[model samples]
Target: MTITINTSEIPDTATEADRALKAKHAAMWASGDYPAVATDIVAALGGVLVDTLDIRAGHCVLDVAAGTGTSALPAARRGAVVTATDLTPELLDLGRASAAEHGLQLSWQVADAEALPYDDGAFDAVMSAIGVMFAPHHQQAADELLRVCRPGGRIGVLSWTPAGFIGQMFAVLKPYAPPPPPGASPAPLWGSGDHVRQLFGERVTDFVARERSLPVTRFADGAEFRDYFKRNYGPTIAVYRFIAGDPDKVAALDAELAALGDRFLAEGVMHWDYLLVTATRA
Candidate 1:
């Protein structure tokens, strides 16, 4: 049985500003060729997460904030019934097309990480791969992640650590980016084991955490890495967009990003640190 949610109804209390911000968020992600970014870089991270969850055939899986089915496709390949949800429909369209090409059967839906529409305990396993951490409301998103998971079901998440290359990149971009919404937590906080424990609290058990590195060799040097992200990554693009009118600020951000990449690059590879967390819904 394929379970799905109807997303036609927006919350009654959603303010105009809230709608506008969500529109902007959707635009930022849709602005880039993120599917290429996923395919070219970080492709291995998804399979690693699926293995951690021990997803099996016939398991009902939900991939929240799934970007082009990074983890969803892998789960489907294992013969699990998969539902891949993301806030951006453009990305979902590409993911659907990719799945069609591979003969992988999975449902794709547009869904917000903070307000998932499914019934309680709808999935046997719930996961996200560097996806849910970007939601503006951390606690709400975390609650939704746990809510949809069946009791004793597996839950897994993989995110970039605060001290890692991607996290440092966010730090470098923070100065130039616009202020986040009220109560919005920094995305890198999801990578902290301590922070996640606080969020999940006693609602989950059998907790396990691992810090690992994903070696990237896609870019030959720091400048290339910066350029690629500027063209492809939404957050990086948003930062550059914020300072577009000032040549001086633009140049400064450019140099900073290049330098950050160079600092991480070693022996023709850059090691990106990430946190992998797994637990059972109590």
Candidate 2:
């Protein structure tokens, strides 16, 4: 038997942006996106931090939002015993299968970041890539992440900076979608923001910021990229769903993305400046 927890239902008091984002990424992460090359770029962006975080072979680490163990499995391979946790169970199945093949052992658990079941000071390190921002209760989640991390241990978070290609791509495609609800872009929550200073300052010590230029591919043309957006961007999916019925909408999305290629790309790599936020206990 297998167990799965559901976080799909939005709370009545939830912000509109929160609900919209959940609907959008829930579908994207579950179904589609750019080539695995683009996915690899994202994985590499996080892998670069491995050395700096120093998740050595023998330490115990918490891999929050360890989606399909992209980061979790790699850490296990490198020798760190890992505890991979996420709300999504199907994704874990994929990770579990892969781990078995590689002979890696990841303690799999279904738990919420806001309400971690682990004891205080249970981890040597806590890390989340592109996940902390999306937690509905970010403050609580941060506290929990901190709670599990040993007093002298560390926490590292990486997210996409909002500007340049990553930001612009969303801008050009925003119109094709619905208006964003407030506080929608949750996971990329701390891209160049003071939240890092305030949140970590109170909980841990030795906070630091690091910048990395991540390699990413742009849509072949603006049009080609927009098609990717319809599936990936939150508001756009809601917009298309509103404007066109499901069956014709996907086809229409292709047509529309193709229509806008000229504006998005003459030639450019989608800008992907990744932000690495690190903090250590005092």
Candidate 3:
């Protein structure tokens, strides 16, 4: 079955709703120490993008919704002129410090993926590593990625699949969380080639997608993994905190997530499956 979403049909009330949603998203991300959680595998993810896109010296690259310089720092280290943007100032601060430690220069800014602050065709390549997918307005975010990329320039994306570990975890937590507002697209859709193609529409060419596994080994065991995410992961923390008043609901969610972790665990390690998307501006 095909589902069509008409963003234009949004009522005037949606403006305030969108603002509220954005605020919540920013606050949720800022609530926990995301760098602690993302630091381990971010470089690996960035390396994949660098290799896949053949990011080389002198190419201008933009990393949207960048959290703690995941892809930006690596691209800079490879001699590319990189600019990183994110909605959270804390993440940017962490990213800046990380870049300084590596003695790499990168332009960092506080910007939203839905409304990028860059000019048209301002970059040779645009990418987001498990970022941008969380933007409530998926179409707008996709448009901005395409807009800032020069014609023929490459656009790369990494996102968790709906059938992947992270996706399943979110599903397990959904019952305890508040429902998403109308017209808000689920972030995992970005991991689907069909959804991505529909979002990019006719504005892109040579679209390609590949599935890959990212190792997640922050915790020693399933129980530890559950505790770590509840304490440190943004969305996980947010959901637990939101339902804190209901002990029963919180416990249920915790149990479900722990079970999910156990299901995905193998040899004391967990693997998250993600989609790597590559396309050229038409």
Candidate that scores best on TM-score: 1
In order of appearance, the predictions have TM-scores of 0.97, 0.75, 0.93
User: TM-score of the candidate numbered 2?
Assistant: 0.75
Each model's number of backbone clashes?
0, 6, 0
lDDT of 3 by residue, 1-282 (tens): 111222353333336777788888888999877887776544578677877888999999999999888888889988998889898888999999988988998888887788776777888999999999999878889998998899999999999999999888878888888888887888888989899999999999999999989887665666777888887889999999889999899888878888888889888778999999999999
User: Which pairs of residues have clashing backbones in candidate 2?
Assistant: 133-186, 133-187, 134-187, 222-261, 223-257, 223-261
lDDT of all predictions, in order shown? 0.91, 0.65, 0.85
**Per-residue alpha-carbon lDDT of candidate 1 for residues 1-282, written as tens digits (9 for 90 to 100):** 779584455354556776677788888999878887999999988798799999999999999999899999999999999999999999999999999999999999898888887888999999999999998888888998999999999999999999999999999999899998887899999999999988999999999889999999998989999999999999889888888999999999999999999999999999999999999999
As for TM-score, the candidate ahead, 2 or 3, is 3
User: How do the residues 1-282 of candidate 2 rate in per-residue lDDT, one tens digit apiece?
Assistant: 112233343224445665565555445554543224325446675465466688889888888866677677777888887888866665677779888999998888865566666767778888877666656566767787888888999888776666644544445445556655553444444666476667665777778877666644656666656666666544355566666756665675566556555443445654466678888965
Superposed model 3: Cα runs more than 4 Å off: 1-14
Stretches of candidate 1 off by over 4 Å are 6-13
Best by lDDT: 1
TM-score of 1: 0.97
RMSD of 3: 6.1
Lowest lDDT sum, 10 consecutive residues, model 3, at 1-10
